[model samples]
Target: MCTYITEPVDLEGSAKGARGWQRIERAHVSFDHPQHAPLDHALEIDLIDGSGARVAVELSAASARALIGAMERSLERGEAETGEGAA
Candidate 1:
């Protein structure tokens, strides 16, 4: 069953697409039929830049949760190393 729910939001980050790495300005998250993922349905995320650059990722629900947690840890470590999280 397709969820057909798309949640889009503005974001700041960098994603590597076909051309190269580009700044991400917006992101669209949805759980629906995937084009390439080897599953009936997957959580799809589309990262888009203001300049029209785009990057897409499709992962299983469990994989998506793991990715989110890993990303949070990675960012926290980077901020800690740079003392950016210090008051």
Candidate 2:
């Protein structure tokens, strides 16, 4: 079953695609059937840039959750070191 659940977020970063590093402008996050992942459904993340360059990722639900946790932890440590508040 396709969930058709997607969320678009504006981003300011760079992603390495086939062509090389591109300035990422936005990201589309969805939970649906993956194009290549070996699972019935996976978390899909498509990072896109202004010039239409893109970096795509598909992760299992458990992997996605772990990634999220790692990101949060890294951000927390970074913020503490920089004396910055969470954004």
Candidate 3:
């Protein structure tokens, strides 16, 4: 079932697209019927630039959770390297 809900967020990051890495200024996260994934429904993330450049990803709930965990770990590692929370 499609959630029919999309939440747009301001993003300050870069995503690799067909034209290589590009700055992404916005993102839309939603649970919807996927356009390409094998699943009937997916957690979809669309990264978009102001100049009309875009990249899309669709993941199952389990995969999305795994990815989120991986991202959290990566962020923590980065912060550790930079001594973000050290006294």
| Cα lDDT, model 2, residue 19 | 89
- The TM-scores of all predictions, comma-separated, are 0.83, 0.92, 0.86
Steric clashes per prediction: 0, 0, 0
Candidate order by decreasing TM-score: 2, 3, 1
Which candidate number maximizes TM-score? 2
Candidate 1: list runs displaced more than 4 Å.
Answer: 51-53
Query: Tens digit of lDDT per residue, candidate 1, span 27-82?
Result: 99999999999989899999999976679999999999999999999989999898
Write down the worst ten-residue block by lDDT for model 1. Answer: 78-87
- Winner on TM-score between 1 and 2 is 2
lDDT of 1 at 80: 83
- Superposing all C-alpha atoms, what RMSD in Å does each candidate have to the true structure? 2.3, 1.2, 2.8
Please identify which of the two predictions, 1 or 3, would achieve the higher TM-score against the true structure. Answer: 3
In model 3, the runs with Cα more than 4 Å from the true position are 84-87
Give the alpha carbon lDDT tens digit for every residue of 1-87 in model 3: 768879999988899989889899999989999999999999999999879778999999899999999999988898889878523
How well is each residue in 1-87 modelled by candidate 2, as lDDT tens digits?
989999999999999989889999999999999999999999999999997667999999999999999999999999999999856
lDDT of 2 at 56: 98
Q: Decide which is better by lDDT, 2 or 3.
A: 2
| C-alpha local distance difference test of each model | 0.91, 0.94, 0.91
CA shift of 62, model 1, Å: 1.0
